[model samples]
Target: MRRTSSISLTCLVLASATLGPALTAQSAAVTPDMVQTGSDIPAKWEEPHPGYDYEKREVMIPMRDGVKLHTVVIVPKGAKGLPILLERTPYNASGFSTDRPHMRDAVWSAQRDWADDGYIIVTQDIRGKYGSEGDYVMTRPPIGPLNPTKTDDTTDAWDTIDWLVKNIPESNGRVGMIGSSYDGWTVTMALLGPHPALKVAAPESPMIDGWMGDDWFHYGAFRQVNLDYFTEQSSQRAAGSQVPRPGSDDYQDFLDAVSAGHWAEANGFKQLPWWNRLSAHPAYDAFWQLQALDKLVVQKPASIPTVWLQGLWDQEDMYGAVHTWEALKAAGHASNNHLVMGPWYHSQVNRSAETLGPLKWKGDTAADFRRTILIPFFNTYLKDRKAAESLPAALIYNATENHWDKFADWPGVDEKHLTPMYLQSEFGLALNKPQAGEDSYLSDPAKPVPYLAPPVEADGGKRWQTWLVQDQRPVATRTDVLSYQTPVLDRAVSLEGAPFADLFVKTTGTDADFVVKIIDVYPPNDAEQPEMGGYQLPISLDIFRGRYRKSFPNPEAIPAGAVEEYRFRLPTVNYVFKPGHRIMVQIQSSLFPLYDRNPQTYVDNIFFAKPEDFRSATMTVEHNPQAASSVLLPIVSGK
Candidate 1:
């Protein structure tokens, strides 16, 4: 228990609340008429939940194309046949409102503490987004046998769980699916086809793999700040396209004037056409795997009971939770699965409990992940109960000794493949050790690095995991950024699993863009702790897009410096490098606008580039050991 004291012991249960004795018997007196409810109310109504007794309604289910979606259940007051926690979303699932009281301090909501802890929550709105209907197919729509107007997303979540287990009343037929990030891709697209009252799922940080290359696109590039600010703060009225809401202080000062790029009189594309149809798809073809969504985690749909939440400093859907946990462990379903990964980010359980970024954990890692790993993982498999069956199918948290360990698997058989730490002094990085003479850089797809992350002003803050560690500390203080260091740790260095980067290079130009960064410096502490000024200390980072390395399905054109060998996997970390921390690696090309401008001229389609193929490309970094450029940590040891 020492990842810096597991963020001060999960910040004292991050605002402890099982709904605190039902919000200490109500009345903290908030009234917009206590959130309005009449239409002759009754459908087993009761509402007024600050503490408990909630039971609200609004059902209308259908959808197999017969369309009728709109759901919002709730339930708490003496609920008996429980077990139905679900949460499908295109966002507004009517704020999961039961007269809005149970926010006993939320950072990730789905009715805090599952309606006074008895379950039966429900909250839907999938088909065509708001109010639900028909046309809103973004993520996984094309089912098996490869495309033929397939109709999927698990057949609209198996006709909305067959009309909520035949009209919901105290439904204990059992069902469980949690949310976070497109409600974690609608519980990984409603745990695929298997709906016999589902069983359990916990998708957190998912967009499963839709906006391509993992959330709004990255490796195939074009995630220009979360698909241009989530295509202008979503609400295309599910694509029929409607507008008039824009004023969040005039869209935060037009994203502070396009986060300073001056994108032609910024209206960020007059309310984002899903970021202009994702710059009309760039590479990893089949139109981003027909809008990915990890093809619904390799269709394991059913034997449920899973729990996956990732955030190694998340920075938005960390490769859709590491490629949907490696396609649900290659479809064998890893004995009912459970994975966690911490160092939080991307709404790290509602940021700001003093600090998460400049590393200050000692408490509330999102209320101890909703009471020690989501209420004992829904009281051990949707209330059949055993309360975490001897726990630890996996429970990581480990950021720089931020604690929470236990692991039976999920990258923990005590990995230790460690070796490549090359990049000798142009400034940093050493392992096979040598201080040579080689450091070239001139990337420029028309002057990049404006993907934006300087103290976050917004316009989807150019997504290199939202300027992670301020985009590798300005590409390690650029000279065309090439710092790589590793000579500061004598004893402690625990980096529990998954991170690869191998490159042997040469590129003067025919096509070039190699960016790799993995840092976590922190040793020079204090500058201000007024509640930790400028949160970002244990320093975690991630970025990779070297022309999708070798085949994310064909892309080549690097003839200039000519001498290539690229491989990148980086992004999946559990970090722990104490004893005065320092483990950096930064190599650059450009993370600009969170990746888009390649144009080194392989152009079959880089979204029709022609700003004179955005010139500038001299980039190399081979610091020879027989050209073995490095970074491949897994590292864990002994029992």
Candidate 2:
């Protein structure tokens, strides 16, 4: 089942979702209703008005190194001195047109507010993507003082901004940038000593670093399927290449590829330059050090005002937004830095829906966010409008209460808010450390735990987007997973910050992986939501490759039968465990497909390991008074 060319890999990867009948049925049930054709705009948002007379034009903007980027500009006709709103994306900017009705798509419909505000909106294809002419560098590093001539995203952005302010008509010379995911990364790049014209930015769900917590890896563990899919989709030689579909049983194809020991060969890695580069660097070395956003904040703090938007349940880049915000604040930019998190997925900030997965909000969450929060933040810095009095340093939405809350700063700017919930024997969670005892489980790489059930197809589909909030009942009873839960609470326990797992464990093998999940267990007889009864909703979760426990750059084998501590942070979440709901902590070794399986045998690079290297291992979690395993929940005081 070796996929040869990059084009063939793209086809097979695109078709990866065509699993058997079981997956088809499961996907039908989980697919979001927001996938409907026609307008994504709500009926209330569609009010007739004297539409803005806008002119659209496409042009090639040259970078400092002579690379030309394809850009699209839409300006209101006869309007003068309008500020510029820019978005750079690898997803292609050709789709950005002012001719469409307000109800067209979420991206287009989202601009209605900006359109009504009479601002010039611009979208550009990043270098080496779409109509842009240049070589593509995945997660291009920011420029530094020593390498002033280096052609990176920062130089490209600076050149683009300089050209736009000078060449575009009716421009106020004030520029603001916004984007999500890869586009978000571009916005972050613009923060590297931004051009004088760039005033504001909002980077949503940006991939801060591949070595840390982002799309490529999570704490040293490779994100196998995600990396494969994204590389196949974005690293094409030509823009707008239609992704080809694989034959039926796409899930089987992925499984067969994994069993064969080389995902690179299985996905046609040899044909793509990015894949080749990715394969060459399996460890956190100089290759990934250059892409670290935290380092960039410390070295070059952007004095320009910026706002970060994050989805509490974002499957990818959740840590990037929260950590980047923290880094900026630590760099003494707290006054101008702001963060807003809501109950949404990766790019759902642009959506207009009120419900995500089985959970429903009180009102249209996305619409309200865009109308009240997003638009105003940009207006203040870009258009020189009065700042909204309602905006705060941190604005977070509570999932259980279905209302927004404000804070002076994220995590309350105090360390006392962090509370530890200790793990106890017999599947219990308590505030106090229990008697000396331990629990053990056999982890077989051959039968790695599935991250989500009803089984995910190869193509990922909607499941990939919504799986973060999927019900965890499928793996709750699995023997390989250890579950520790607290009794139903008498009062609501609201968690407002990042949660971290402190586990003291022993393993029979040299190396392993640790996966921790914080879940909310619904009551059984909640008649209003029978389908959600006893549902174990994961609030925040992450995997830590045990080899990186001491250092991310160095790999060391764990001594057999030796107790070691593995502490890692899960993505932050703001949620209330209402009365009668239980808080659960599930620990496991592997999250298949979502993360690559750890062979349990110490190897320099697991990516290139032989199939025979994978072995079963006996792992134990100690819960003694001294070696107490617990989860620290950042409980907001007086919540």
Candidate 3:
């Protein structure tokens, strides 16, 4: 990877300014109100209110630890006995000004229905950020009852809710919490035995465990570009903080650093405290385990009604939402736990949900979601409304048919009917396993496979939001990548749960990385859309570091030239492989700057490996009756 100079930053800024309105228009055109059978109106369809007749106040709410967190509260003028909707976030809460509250924050725009319903809206800055009095702890771990007075996110949330319900005049004494991404994590933290006032929560795309499959690391493989960019953006805050130096081409910068054998020194990783702490704990040690929300959800089952909203195409924290939902269900909170999954990117539930990349849905998906699903859930629990009684335990949007489906319970492994798609020697996907054969590829670290190409820009660019659903045609031609496709499907195969890949592989080196992508191949002669006739849309993908095959906490080097079995889970997707569309699987060693390259030479800590540690390796994937390499699809029948 290489870094671009300040010039690239200027160009990126100018490009964003020029293209902002056009993109907004395109989204509006694609995502207009489409639901017909409901009296409930979509937020986008509703005419904008002239102004909020509310009394706005900014206050510093003190926690048990004596840290004052900055908070903004908006109450309807002369309104009393209203339910409270709270959102605590690391992102700046001041962005939502009371005078002009029409912002992109989902708590405001996406849930405008709540405002019309007369619930008090509140947003707060978490500790250690702008206007907050305490140091920010990234992904603050929950402090259980074992340690009293030891304040954490859980304690802070309890204190905040405790204070709000007691102190806020004209309060109904009932509260609901909701947030997406980092704020979502805060919502999950509060779910560890929520305060008495807290009745319901919706944590959308929360970060569960960074090391497993959330935002930072993917099964021990570090996500370099995203982590670096996020750290730089968040590290410096507070009034009058010095503006950081601008840099472009984060992909190139990281690649050059790793290539030059000076990863830490080149990128100045030490300066970023979170990165320093993360690098120190490479494996899933106590550092990451403490931050795992699944553990908390299991140990202390959520008593409050909770709705987990997740995007099937969420690039960052898909694992967090799904894993947390599963954990909660396993912990015997099935009746209180519900899930809503849609064809969306991270936080795109607030934006246009009708289309993602080249794929489009039937209706104004986002609008329908807000009007029918989101508002009713919160209203039922927070305000004791009966309208939400009809909501299902699981409301999943099937990308395959572009329709919503209801389930009595989540279709977990027990209910899933799996069909194995085996890899064949002729680069084909077969229902039956091959007798005996193997395919090999030389993975050169110097020329790794790009996750998306013509590479993404350094600064926060549009590709960051759209890349997960982007066409995979760019890397399909690379020799290092192995492609296998099934013949055109006679009928649609619907997948509703998690997908897993089982591979028997042999690497020439002591360690390596395996990347698997499940894709949907479109027909070439489609007259409706010629440009997307042969588009390869990735349904789900994941990376695994070979060293961690045996134990995530204790990784060991692979025995050179020895065959081994490697099984890993890709994020779940609710998609149907429609007729005429082929199901394809791609295997590759490295997905460039997106994930840090596995040096092929096993080192105690990959973060500190020298340039010489990086080496090219020959990798083989065996597909035979004995060592069959197959992708398991959780096919749903009768729908």
Query: Model 1 reaches what TM-score against the true structure?
Result: 0.35
Model with the higher TM-score, candidate 1 or 2: 2
* Clash list (residue pairs), candidate 2: 11-244, 15-246, 16-459, 17-459
List TM-score per model, in order: 0.35, 0.88, 0.87
Off by over 4 Å in 3: 1-52, 101-108, 144-149, 239-248, 259-264, 414-417
Native-referenced Cα lDDT, model 2:
0.81
**RMSD to truth, every model:** 26.8, 16.4, 16.2
Q: Which 10 consecutive positions of candidate 2 have the poorest summed lDDT?
A: 98-107
User: Candidate 1 or 3, higher lDDT?
Assistant: 3
lDDT of 1 by residue, 1-639 (tens): 469788876776775655576677676758696685666656774545556455567776876557788888766666678787777877677855624444333213535666556777777887777787776645545565444554565677777777777777677777777778877777776676667777778888877665444566556655544434444335465433322234433223323333322342143453444445545555576656754655645744456777777776666677776666656666767677677766667646534333454456778677667766677777776776776545566777775566777778766322356656667745566665554446677766655554354333344423334345442454456566676666666667666666677767787666666667776665555354553322223233345445666676576666666668777666766667665556777777666655555656556555555556557777777666566577767766541
Error of 3 at 453 (Å): 0.3
Tens digit per residue, CA lDDT, model 2, 1-639: 564787787888667656566677876785566477777677754434355356667899988778899999887768799899899987778875635433222138667677777778889988888789987767766655323447888888899999999998799899999888888888888898699999988898888887789888889888876654554556573552322436443344545555323755665556666667676777788778877886786688888888778898888777677788887787778888888888898888877658888889988898888877777878887777875675788889988888998889776333456688999988899898878899999999878888756346664666877888889888889999999999888888888788888999999999999999999999987798899999999999999999988988887999899999999888888888999999999999988867788889998878777677789999999999989999989886676
- Superior candidate under TM-score, 1 versus 3: 3
Off by over 4 Å in 2: 1-52, 98-107, 144-149, 230-234, 239-251, 259-261, 412-417
lDDT of 3 by residue, 289-357 (tens): 877888878888868988888898888787888788887787777888888888899998877677888
